[model samples]
Target: MATHKRAETLMDSVCEDMEEKPEPYFSFGIIADIQYADIDNGYNFMKTRMRYYRNSLTLLKEAVQEWDSESTKPKFILQLGDIIDGFNVPQKTSDTSLAIILAEMEKLKIPFHHIWGNHEFYNFKRKYLMESKLNSKPLEDEIGQLTINEDTSETRSDQESFYGYHFSPYPGFRFLLIDCYDLSVIGRDTMSIKYGMSLKLLKEKNPNEDLNSPRGLEEEQFVQFNGGVSGAQLNWINSVLASSDEQDEKVVVIGHLPIHLDSTDAICLAWNYKEILSALQSHPCVIGYFAGHDHDGGYSVDASGIHHITFKGVIETPPENQAFGTMYMYEDKMVLKGRGLVLSKTLHYRNGRKEEPVH
Candidate 1:
């Protein structure tokens, strides 16, 4: 908790020094948890967080306009998932909700790389999502030259999309997009192996019949709203990390669910995050992890040099406010230029274990 606070305190001062920093190698815009719907604003099930379902689309529109007007225009935009609210389906606005959000996103003309969140399951099934536009398919001029001879990543396979694909915008640097919900109960048929596995895990960790409730559970990650990384996906992550290591490239992982306990509430983490976190920490090439699930965002650099940033949720922002930013990737550090509620932070150490303070 002290590390988290100290990071934020430094972020408050870092923005003013941006003019003095070296030129960034590349830049990209980031926004998450738009969670838009056609319904009016309402409180969450626990009533601790109020969601502005309708106004989030407007926020996206403004964010799009802001990004479109930027001189350096991001190489690509990372839509960190939960693009539409879960309530949209029960509210009978799933189709229209998605259409409007996509329309707003289309205005930017930049490639959007999306992460799959649990709210997405509330709106659409996994089969549909496999071929959806939300999947971050690498675009040529935007992402660098293809390194792989054969396409074996997420978008190519219609049956299942456990993509551990790398988006190389700059040489020796990659954004590894991971699928955290590959083994989840949400949107999966009850009889499916993945679904069974998720159920068994949840039952063991959480006693509540209302699976979403994390009440008595010591480890809150067992809730139904969260998911896990499958064994296949873990292997893929390792393979991609090995490939990136061989190529001498540094990687920044992008996903929906937060993997670090300190980076987010236990309720918002992946079930098998310990395993996933171990994989990232052990890999010297893996420098950072970006995600959104906890509406109240968090930041913390682990004992390892990896920087974990859970972006603030768009839906959590009031209609009058917004949460978005542009991330500038410098050779030695990454700087996030926040627009509204998102704070600008300098994650300085990318590769070595010699941890540095947030600037």
Candidate 2:
């Protein structure tokens, strides 16, 4: 609870400084893990995540509208990932959830971009949907006239669907919506990680068992991950960053997973947070990395000036699932803002008693 207060103070401090700045600035909203549409048998099924998240969205919309009523709203809105627990549920359920979220985002009237989460693959591998290896035809055959630009299409329906990373024409900043999960083919190393015990040991451990048994690990903890940016996707990310560097653009990398964990300093190399940090450190254009997945709120700073932030989850139940927000680069000082919303009254009381209230 005391922790939540600190988070709120962080947000307020950031907001206050922005207000004091002489130059006009833009601010946007990010919502994470609104795993909408689970009828039953799941944590946030049957629109439970949606119910709480819609409220948060409403609050955010009102705030943005009140702040910028006369002109265009902040450059855009970003839905970080786990928009739906697609990997764990039926395709229709997840798709419907995505549709609802898309509708809500549309009401904001800003260009919204979505990042792919591990769940968006209908509880399957992300690599399958990345390249054009899948069986489906292009969007023209499936959803005709739904696409706005055919010539500028970055999406390949036959492969994994990518909403494309979005960028603002706004000065001094760029947002990269990275597709960390590859859905085309499973690599040998990735298979090893997914299986946990390693391929060599698989035969030794289950000598008499079938070659492709359940692998003894539960579905929830399945690996099926490639980890860091590698191969073609890595090249793409580098190219994108290089282009941004050429233009002297300040970048804020947004993804679903945390670059570093607050509980432990373990760095997951598969996603390349460390490598990404190292690469972005020399560039004045790279400000920070914003992400979710840990559901805990904290900021980590390496030897370099770059900042990595893990945002709280929106669908976490009363005591554990409380939601929050953070602001960066809102002013000259790059103050950070944090806030706690939809908390349990008991938890609030416990937290409130521990902290000094802002005047």
Candidate 3:
């Protein structure tokens, strides 16, 4: 595959004839549930997690270096979600774990986008039930927001602690980073007076059957509750795709969990066949979809022509949290090259047209 250049002339030509324009390709690092945390000293989980970060970072460093040499490296990095396992742990501890992982990532020198998984939702109750101090209006009207610093450190204020759901500037491309963890559709800074009504209902009724067990909820219920990239997110995605179509540019979608897994039986349905297939059918410019959830790596493309990729785990040992290599986009395809202490270019993807080992 030829490495497409992003020079103004090429971009202009591509923009002029999107159909004729060979698909624009990018190489980015995708991983989920790094769940960086200090486990019980006696437990082997922490030891394995520590190694995952070390090895994954090592591979990422190499990929970034190679791309950096080319004028067009990656537009940025995408972390599907679960950067850390326990969102409710003491903020101090979470901060320390995050710092360790993010600090290492800073060396890459590219914007890192993240999504908020269920584990990241901590103050959902209080923030919704609180009084108004941050704003004159009640909390329900406010939108949750969280900013992931370039260094990978996260600072969240309850008023708007929604993480990593934002826009990135790209020529002919619009990128939306959503914080899927924030389940409530309303804001939380104002007193329960406004948005608290729903919070109260949820507390009393507990709509989520698995509120007690984070891992127990069915994928379908999860998606029905907060899975599909619809509502504000769907609207945002549609608008971006529309804009791209009007300009005749390629539009790419990224999320922590694939649309398939986001709304079905996580184990049974390896991919979101219906919803994703439909979306791609409707939006043709949507050239690719990248996600990380199932620790083991896998890839699938539906009849509608959408590619779904699940990268390997970073932690490669034990009952959970195994080690895995990183995936990158090369030319018109995405590449999954081996990383960590172990090395093999066994896993990866090409553009929408090809499978792993893009070459």
Candidate of highest TM-score: 1
Q: Could you tell me every candidate's TM-score relative to the true structure?
A: 0.87, 0.59, 0.56
Q: What is the clash count for each candidate, in the order shown? A: 0, 26, 22
Report how far off residue 166 is in candidate 3 (Å).
Answer: 6.8
Q: TM-score of model 1 relative to the true fold?
A: 0.87
Quality of model 3 by C-alpha lDDT: 0.44
Q: Please give, for residues 1-359, the per-residue lDDT of candidate 1 as tens digits.
A: 99999998888779757757667888999999999888878997789888988888889989999999988899888888889988887778887888889888888888888888888888888777766776566442343343433335544544445544667887878888887788778847676666787788879888997998989888988888888887778877887677776677788999899988778877899888888988887677888999998889998888787899999999989878889999998878888999788999988865554343332
Which structure is stronger by lDDT: 2 or 3? 2
Better of 1 and 3 by lDDT: 1
lDDT-sorted candidate list, best first: 1, 2, 3
Which residue segments of model 2 deviate by more than 4 Å? Answer: 1-20, 38-72, 87-92, 123-166, 183-222, 225-227, 261-272, 317-331, 341-359
- Name the top lDDT candidate: 1
Error at 147, model 1, angstroms: 7.8
**Residue 185, model 3: Cα distance from true site in angstroms:** 9.7
Q: In candidate 2, what are the lDDT values of residues 133-229, reduced to their tens digit?
A: 2211121113221222232223343232333353643565667665554321232224433233333433443343443233563221123332334
Pick out the ten consecutive residues of candidate 3 with the lowest summed lDDT: 132-141
List ranges where model 3 is wrong by over 4 Å: 1-26, 40-75, 87-92, 122-174, 182-230, 261-277, 315-332, 338-359
